[model samples]
Target chain A: MSGLVVERATPLCQLQDAGRFGVRHLGVTQGGALDWVAMGWANWLLGNPLGAPVVEVALGGLRLVCQRDACLALAGADLQARLDDQPLAPWRHFAVRRGQVLDFIGPRLGARTYLAAPGGFLAPAVLGSCATVVREGLGGLAGGGRPLQAGDTLDWRGAAPVAREMPAALRPDLAAPARLDLVVGAQIGGFDSRSLFDAFNADWTLDTRGDRMGVRLQGPVLDYRGEGLVSEGIPPGAVQVPPDGQPFVLLNDRQTIGGYPRLGALTLLAQARLAQCVPGERLRLRARDADSAQREHRRYLERWRQV
Target chain B: MNPRIEVVAMDALMLRLFDRIEEDNLPWLLAARQRIVEAFGAALLDLVPSYTTLMLHYDVTRLDLAEARRRLAAALDGLRVPEDDGGARHTLPVWYDPRVGPELTRLAERGGLEPADVIRLHSERDYRVFALGFAPGFAFMGLVDPRLAAPRLDTPRQRVAAGSVGIAERQTAAYPLVSPGGWNLIGRTPARLFDRQRDGYSLLRPGDRVRFEAIDHATFLRLGGDDTPLAPTGRAAA
Candidate 1:
């Protein structure tokens, strides 16, 4: 195991890989880091596997002390982090000597942050993943769904150099406003043209009710005229409009089945962008077909293998 | 002739199980499941069979979806839900009294039957376990006597305790865990339907047949049954 001890960690922090998969029929939702792009880049900076585990920090305000000298990489949102009062930024690599305190006061940009160690964190894989799902009581260090509480120590078995920097081209841009590309679901037509127009043209505000399950978008009331549809398999990025006429884009932790009339799933690439938006963030929708959505999804997946 | 097959995306292909569920469609549903499992190995991420369709989730990164559809079409072109594999019939026990079953009175009235009559009619039907979804161990069983068919609550409860036995439309189900739900809760089952520690996480799977056996409070307490006995296991597919 690498020489590193966590003197302090917070509940909002936990080890995450890409996600847990292949068990949705068992009703298990895929749980992983929200900002998948950042998670990949953090791992890439350390020359580790693209899916290596990392600490997913949400809304910052986390502190950890390196008991043994260790090197680490930080990526994703710039959470205004510091090393024992020495200021540090994200999308770069850094190190802390023994007894040095690493603190993430808060996010400077995006809502979530990713911190990567050399070989990923040491945690047991529950059902083929270490991503934590507090609702399901699965994944994480204890292998029972729970977040990293203060005083918890995260340990990893792999080690690398003190620090390394990711190239400018490799870092993700957090300044760009989130624009989600949606593949107008087949039911898009079932919705009156008026609803469709608002779906793509109007800017929606991210509702605070959002969680891993789904994000409720506050915008023009979306209407889909149809007899209530039968319950069917729900996919990630599914934009379901409940009776209230609001659209909710289901995310990684969403249930496997639903019955509400769905506008359709947002492309996978759009899902990644949606993952980072903070509450009240303005989002514009762009319509595309399956062929175009698939192409963009393919291009996004190719980024990890490009290394 | 095969029903229309559509490509939802690169990783998912939709197999119209049927336009609507009917007696004849069960055979097609079962056979298609086996064919997909045999044909698609690592490429198949999930096989989601719903009321009238099968959504196959695959790895778009590794294999193209059109190819998957072709392969799946070839296997399930002409199939049906096979004869039951001679599985044992599980008789679950339940108590459907008003104190224990808050929704019993409403459901009984809707069915035009007394509470006991509704309970007896519900327990008589041997319902096939459709596919499990919504939540872990949440079993979506079938159309109770049509007379018992009820609409889902207009307002969903903030939290439906685990093992709550509920009926909605023609379907009856048990909630394995506490979550917001709209099902018309008729009773509560103390029997753990989904205990992660138990060897069987879910007792019902898709295609399994289940029957409920009505029991009085005395027997219910002896069996440690809550208002409804919802000892669900993950091993079975419903």
Candidate 2:
């Protein structure tokens, strides 16, 4: 089978798609590309489905050797990717010769980079998804929740189309001091006025202890006077405040249910941008109405459809 | 009665039926889940039923926030509890010994009860599976006998064995996978709470009723139970 052989990779490198849905009720979390916007753009460049499985390389350190002539798309963070000693940039699709080497040195700006094939790398689907979620022991090339490893071969079925490039306007600037849009949740009213004021007014720094599950935000100690909460279903991007008052934003791989009070959830676009942020980056939370957030989300999806 | 609706996120809504956890709410929650599924057939991406809430995740492109809420309200306008009894009943056999359950003696001593009495209290009542989270197939069953109600450990153990039957603050559950947990352990069950080969990849579903049946050591081993003692021996606590 025509494919690429993995010569080197870090643990953070894994395959992902839009995510696994209709399975949260079974205690399964939705795992996918943390920077979903990049995943979509990569797939779009290949003329593939926007949610097709792609390799998500975080803090890049991966090297692959093409086994056959293939056209692949690269998008999201500038990982300083190189194709056989030639400098390669993101947001574009290019061709590779058989036995040519592809290397991703390290992150130049963003925290993650996405690589997409024409029909998505071939992998057996588990629970109707190829998205690898290590914690749940599901999905991936082997359908065993394992990340891409050295000596593994990745192949796809579809034929590649004409090369394409993403417009500069569509590309996001993954710079520091990000302003995240947060849609207020039910527990917003229960927090004291001072806590609410501190939540939006102050700047929060991303902590080092972060992963696909969640990221801790270091900032003012907001207070919560709400009664004890019963454990309930948690949505992606939920900014939950524990008793200590420090807030943590739950991500794609977060547990299905939790009991902590939440200020609200970040908009999908904000989640994508946050995925690109490195540790110690400063960010501010901006309150956004659900209607406006939803409208913006629709507009983003429309871009993919038009493409 | 209409449930309180909360905009959990831009694409998610949580319909809260009650503020507190109650077994009686399971039936209503199950019925609400059915109506909500039927109401937003294709638009609904996921529906999660918990202790007193049913969280719905919708595809924003298919339906707007207001339209999703209107459909949910219309479907639940005259919701009725199904005439049929709640969910399926499951009887799980457990090995209640100190070796596998290190916290058994402490929990017994804290409640001023004999070890046998502790097992009896835990096994006597049928608990309802409220929700599943923390790990795949980890069912959060609840409403334990108040006498057996115990608070979670001040510090969670680095690892809790799978199939460990435990209680935490009026809630009872069996660990589906080995994970970090703070629940007070009372026994270990031989039954596999989670199996990937299973239809749903889980032995118990939300709304199911489960009862624990105490079994002898030999019986436990016969059912493929592992009797490896936890790191910290129960004798130390005893």
Candidate 3:
């Protein structure tokens, strides 16, 4: 089958599914879509499973041309997509004619966007996932862990969408700032009295030191009065306080285990919202219990299933 | 037996098990694992198991932490571990040639013995698989001889080829993949510890015993030493 060629690509673009699992004990981190909500909507436009394969483009600069007629969906950040000089919007499905051009520029709001075809993008699964992790040298197109580069082609086999369209209102309005939710972490109380006050009240700027692995929050270096403890299993969203006092919140590509005093993990939904924010964006940390967070999360997903 | 279940987080339960892995709790821990796994039959997340800890993570919306922990505790209380710990003593044949054991001479000097004496001492000591991390099927074996104990290399190599055995901080192990590591190279076994296509991927597990034997490089490359451990082991053509 004809495939989508990478007329222009960047180091950040790669094929991803939900992620590889059951291998953390082996020290393998789960590498998947950073913004899952956008990934799911892109797949939904093509009637694919929520976790179906999709093209994740970070910081834009991606361009593709349809060798043959194709139906596709674009979601997440609006990169000012255009088809042959015609403007295109996000969170909607669109059909391109043979030899048509689909180009992406800078993000108007979010940092990443997802492109999905009818069935899903095709790629070799390494360790049960096509997700890529360059640091670990695992997952990719051939499953040997290579990221997409210019002149590469991506293919799929599912039938094309019967129609093309996404809700106009649903178009991601990321121009407005994003607010992330947080569920209080396990070691939150171990923090010094002053740090706790600053944690919830003060605004922390997102540091430039960011990647799929984690993002360092530049703010008041939190101090822990608790005894020096041994390192433990770290979870995604864990706000770890290094000896230097900086707090780094581990993310999707984090190591299986870590040795640091952790403030706690952010809830899954919280991580999703954070995925949309760019470096330098200001964020405030808040606390929520597990029960209430779970309920809110369940309600959020229920609406997803109804569609 | 239930591991003093605690709510370390909202959607995940922390099972703080006692150390040393008592016989009675092993079964309970295994059972709790089974139940939690079964609960997320369709939406399985990560089920991370450690030496004395097991953490079950799931979609918060699907299963709340309180309910998951309650179910896990019940399973632990009612479960039973098989009488035997699934393990075996492994005697691995490794080639001690300088080309393979790059640091053998250094180890010999450090231990105040001839190169051959160092090999004999290494081949005699029994080791235990204390944990598996750093890579897939990579076993962190413990109790390397005190004379051979050393801190890891100051600068880690970009790639430590798989099957390469090394020592670091009283721990001995083989690299499951070609990854950057700091362990001091001692020798390499032609045996494959991790093969995805194999039935049980990892050859060694926690609580397993390991011993090293001396062999030549020729035997290391040949004898079907590669992964996919299915060939019948015959003593020799003789």
Candidate 4:
């Protein structure tokens, strides 16, 4: 019966989980946490399943008042969080007294933050996920694919776990210059050797035109020498080169089919890191073999399971 | 020939069956997809079938890239290409109202044909559902009579209403949701292409066959077609 009442909210706040799966064949995009790592950690801090529903607060500007004394977990971006006007850091579980106000003022470290309540937030599952996809009008508090707004109440029924703090070594290093690892795609060889060199060597800046759908990378113009390709299935993290040559990394909510030639797709960890990057953040690309990329992904999942 | 498997991402693999979309490729792609689903079972997170590629998404924790590739290869080897008897056929009733299709006259003019001829050409042939994308339940049906082939609008409309039928190049499809689109509008259908409340959210799936049937306005209303214009009425062209 414990809950938090939304006192203020921004359009960016929405409910998310690991994402909707097994439904992309129906032309429905996978909608979930942009930064899956952060969402998992937030849920882990509460002893909830990794895929439990949580509020994804992007660029902050959200305020909530505890309706009852309860425990919650915060992870991902710092977002300049404050508890009753006092600074509250992320990556740990904390308790709040009744009527205590939790305000996320703005971003400080990363672009997105995850807030998890005990047992996750109560939301109707549409297509086996509570992850809100506003484009499809599915999921969310009311289950109509709407973002959190003022005067809304978030209810959860599970009890909180023992307080815990994320190990310093395991905490994501958001301040470090991002170096994304990309697995070479089928079309990689079709790109001009010069453009391919620039794609890997040149520093790429994250463009301001980005959302849950994709993030455009501003860097060298990648000239694809391949002829026009028949439209085909596009996977998340696929770095597609448009006619203008700017590469955009598709994300959870990308269209299912596309015709653009892809340099490659980023590793899962790289995608998580990219999700936290703000506009204008500079990053470099590194080519990774398929074997190493798969091993690394497995290791990350194994660590989470062990934790 | 064996399908070429390419690692699309850490957890995704794209199996390119052919370079071009052809009727002969459907059976192989469909059989391969079925076999992979049966072989991997729950380990396969998602499988997306497009015109000529099948993207398999798996949980890296459950199956590594090498293991997934091996399993997929084994599955393909065991696949039995079923006869191409065609797929489920649905007769979709369409109301070819000129008021609903803002570009109907323009499209006919470009094709050097009358408006009625354009409608007849579109309705006479059965289209195959090649893939579903752009939006949920939006089936990309194909090979619209070449005579009806026309370029997309120079500028896309801000919003195309749900159920609006559209043609672009050699393809024809109906919009399942109100969204920005550049396809030339031709008619509107009443049948819901996508309904979340339904057992199957999408009415038409890949491999299905669909045919448009011309219907009078009264029949359109009888079949639950709302009189609402597919898009905002009287909107200036983009």
lDDT for residue B89 in candidate 1, whole number 0-100 = 60
Q: Rank the candidates by TM-score, best first.
A: 4, 2, 1, 3
Give the higher-TM-score candidate: 2 or 3: 2
Candidate 1 regions with alpha-carbon error over 4 angstroms: A1-12, A161-164, B85-88, B109-112, B197-200, B216-238
Candidate 2 clashes between residue pairs 3 or more apart in a chain or in different chains = none
What number of backbone clashes does candidate 3 have, counting pairs of residues 3 or more apart or in separate chains?
Answer: 2
Worst 10 residues of 1 chain A by lDDT: A1-10
List candidate 2 stretches off by more than 4 Å.
B233-238
Clashing pairs in 3: A185-A264, B27-B81
Taking the tens digit of each residue's C-alpha lDDT, what string does model 3 give over A1-307? 5668889988788888888887775667888998888898898878888888898888888888887788898888878888889988778888888788888888777888899988888887777888988876677777767788878888886875644455566554666655555666656778988998887777888898999989998898788877554323566677788888788888888876655777777777777777887889888777777788788778766645665
lDDT of 4 by residue, B192-218 (tens): 999888998899988888999999999
Which model is ahead, 1 or 2, in terms of lDDT? 2
Best candidate (score: TM-score): 4
Off by over 4 Å in 3: A162-173, A176-178, A225-232, B6-10, B19-44, B78-81, B88-91, B97-122, B206-208, B223-238
Tell me the TM-score of model 2.
Answer: 0.96
Q: Give the per-residue lDDT digits (tens) of candidate 2, residues A64-180.
A: 999989899999898999999998898999899998999999988888999999878888877878889998888888988899899988988688565676788888888656999
Chain A only, candidate 4, TM-score:
0.97
Arrange candidates by lDDT, highest first: which order? 2, 4, 1, 3
Each predicted model: what fraction of the native A–B Cα contacts (within 8 Å) does it retain?
A: 0.36, 0.77, 0.34, 0.83
Tell me which of candidates 3 and 4 scores higher on DockQ.
Answer: 4
Task: Estimate every model's Cα lDDT from 0 to 1.
Answer: 0.75, 0.89, 0.73, 0.88
